[model samples]
Target: MGASDTAVAMSTKDSSEASLGATAAGPTPAAGTAALAIAQARVSQTDLTGLTLSGRYLVTRKVGQGGMGAVYEATHTLIGKRVAVKVLLEKYAQREAIVKRLKQEAQLASSIGNEHIIDITDFGNTDDGRTFVVMEFLEGESLAECLARETKLAEQRILRVGAQVASALAAAHAKGVVHRDIKPENVFLLKRKDQDFVKVVDFGISKSLRQSSEEEEAVRLTQTGMVLGTPLYMSPEQARGDEDLDHRVDVYALGIIMYEAASGRVPFSGANYLSVISQVLNEEPKPLRDIRPELSEEFEAIVAKAIAKNRNDRYASATEMLDDLNAVIEDPTHSTERAKITGPRRLLPKAPKIPRIAWAIGGAGIAVAAVTIIVALLMGSKAKKQLKNANANPPAARADAGVATVAPPDAGEMVPAVETIKLTIVTDPPGADIFREEELVGKSPQTVEFVKNNKEVNVTAQLPGMEGTTSINPLERKDGAEVKIRLKKLKGPPKVIIKKTGETGPQKQQGGTTSHTGGELGTNPFAGSGTVH
Candidate 1:
């Protein structure tokens, strides 16, 4: 399929049929409607029921479909065991690039020997020249469906799912594999021994960070300017179409998914592909406490690190992230005094005008620079006070001991304070709460003072009955400009607009296969929320 819809989903209608043995059959689709339902998907739909593949597994029914292929539920004709089969579209069979990509998806997935990774047991060409890969059939819903059905999961459930995902990524990274497309839908969850068990699926666009000498030239499917993976969850590097990518992309995506799980919305969302990408590269997601103040500082800090704009600022590896996540799970009150190690327990502000010193200089430089600037200003107060005293008592006043003298200026006045500029933040409604750079500064219609720190900051206006909006300001400009934002009053039911990027012809080409349904995903509800078959 396309990059956006390159995923598979489990059977939604019936799971009991799985109990049937080899000789048994599942419910058959109503007579003529079979073709219509498949066709409605906008693919070269075909009812593959009753067809046997590789002379071993029998295709029972079509389970799901994607950009370049269709997934079918099948059974082992001889052993009676069930499996999921992904078949390349007949038209794409002749294209070497498409064929190689599908084959590689299977090979790379099979290489990672993690219990949480879906098991790929068979891959080969069919009698008609089409390719197929058979995998273990899962029995539960995708994380996408689970979220739709239950908008938010309990904290414990989230922790369990998160831990398993991190564990799986660690194994994948250790094998030099990067699941370039990690999102809620790519994460499959079902019950295992009375507890939630996770099985990460869809490795269609994954890359091998560590490739063998012989396979190097043949495996570069992504061209110089091509951008793969869903725009909503791709890392900043991936969004920019950068050539060099590694495991950190998955780490970044995992944080996005976790943030969505906790807040019921993504940090960045918009009307189309370009809009969402712009936010991802330039905007910071809302803070967890802003939406759910009950969240622990540890959680906020952990997620902040995962999605940091600079890859070096994120956790060095999935293993490192899991360590902190597991701690928060054990005891929410645990002091995540890890700021000493990760720099601070919060998201770094926007990139500064001066280039971020290379990590080659280490984060310690940043910490020292930040600490040095403040200390340099306040530490000289003693000398400034001594000079003031010398100026106040002119040797003449000391000479004439009886002379009245003016009172010495207060100590606070002795030290020259950092220059400050006042920014009057006002919303149309006038009563909304304002947050400047993720911190609750004050209510709208209020004037807040900002130091001339030469850094960029974004201010937001939000209220219960009104829609929120954010504006970015160059707080360093030293101009005390007033920021005014307008809030829309909520009238009735909030509208849910699912913007499709397909109709925009120019963007599709510029986006380079932004989504897989071949832009034919006309009514797929999960269009922008990550591929769910």
Candidate 2:
């Protein structure tokens, strides 16, 4: 049978039924191969089981299936290392745009090496022309699943998760990438080393900020004027189909995520997608604290700023938002208040009943008598010992006693005594503007002094077409330490070179009609795909 015919037939039968058919007869080697072949012919048009890709990954069984592709549990044949293999379905393999988008997701995600972002190991096409990407196999449920089971999360837990996500976004933004879709489904919660860790997944709709004006205008993957994000979590500009978008859209979606995580429901929702989109574009969401009165006003303010209708009103950068979130978490008074909000208020037990004046007078009289007797004895003993010590050694005895009896200096006072270390900042391309803790601190190839007690100093280098960042921990080394940073050139606008077939000279192309020299224009794949969940 033709490949297309087989795929059509496979789509008609249930996946479970096909799996049962593969193991119905026996577990023998020959029977297994036969069953696998039969199942392949009837479903998927390709037998992924027992198949090896790139002569390394051995596909075992399907772990996850999606509209565009399916993820299989695989192991490296030589190293026996576990990994996940996501393959584009045979049905969509012929769709060039979908194939490109699947590959783009892998490339974009792999480029950002953040702990909170999923890691892509490798990507290529199989011998049978099936495209696939290998990624780290993650354990645990998605944030969406957790929220479904627990409804809402605690205030501290929200901040912890939000901070990690914002940190990942900061790294992406530094590289000029924007994660247009931010929702619970994309936030994965994994348990490693008995601690909860988050990994942001699915960059299928992420936009690159490095594209040229012409390229950006030419690439419209979605329907004309159609919104490109989930209605419930979409930013105002995204819902309005504004072409001039930046990382702020991600901030808006993150706000919606925070709001939903704090309360059981999202800030904006309606019976239908259109209604939700309308609310997102034209109306303001109700205050988060109003829905969950237990939530603090500070928390609500953070969320409100994130989902602000005007992008200019939102946090300037993900790092700025993260700093504010960390501040909220570290504030003692705010934390205590948050605890009270989440927990039930309890009344204190009543004090014991007593005659207030009589009890206080009796206690005072006994204390005064005990103190007077103790003072008299201490004075007598001290005088006798001093006379005897003076007669024996005098100055020598006094000096010895002084050395032994004197208390050490306070711990707090010693902090200022340590000399500040000089940290020399040098970059691959010198003269880049340097920033410490978001404050501009002269140009690179400069030296700054920091107290030894300072554990770490964050440095950011910015130039016209290059940028870099690093953290220097003076405590890790001795004083006069030098931190060398390497700045990478940012992606520049695409250069257009037009050639005329008949004429000897090149022609200048203008407007959207300018044809790109190579490859088709890009588009947002999530335009008509709906919410990834």
The per-model lDDT (C-alpha) reads 0.65, 0.66
For model 1, the superposed segments whose C-alpha errors exceed 4 Å read 1-45, 212-226, 331-533
- Cα lDDT of model 1 by residue, 1-533, tens digit: 32112211122112223334212654344423443433433332344566677778888989998878888999998999999999888878787767777788899899998999999989987655788899999999889898898887766577778888999999999999998999998999988787789999988778887776456435455455457788778898998877788899998999888888888888889999889889887666665656787865556656766886657546889998777667657544455442222211222232212212222234444564445334544666574455446446645533333433324444443333344444445565566766655455556554455545646555666687675555444343322223556678778643332224443211121101111111110110111211111
Model 1 pairs whose backbones collide? 1-67, 1-68, 2-516
Angstrom error at residue 364, model 2: 33
425-489: candidate 2 lDDT, tens digit per residue: 55656677766545455665544545445466666776877877776665653332335566788
Best model per lDDT: 2
Q: Per-prediction count of colliding residue pairs?
A: 3, 1
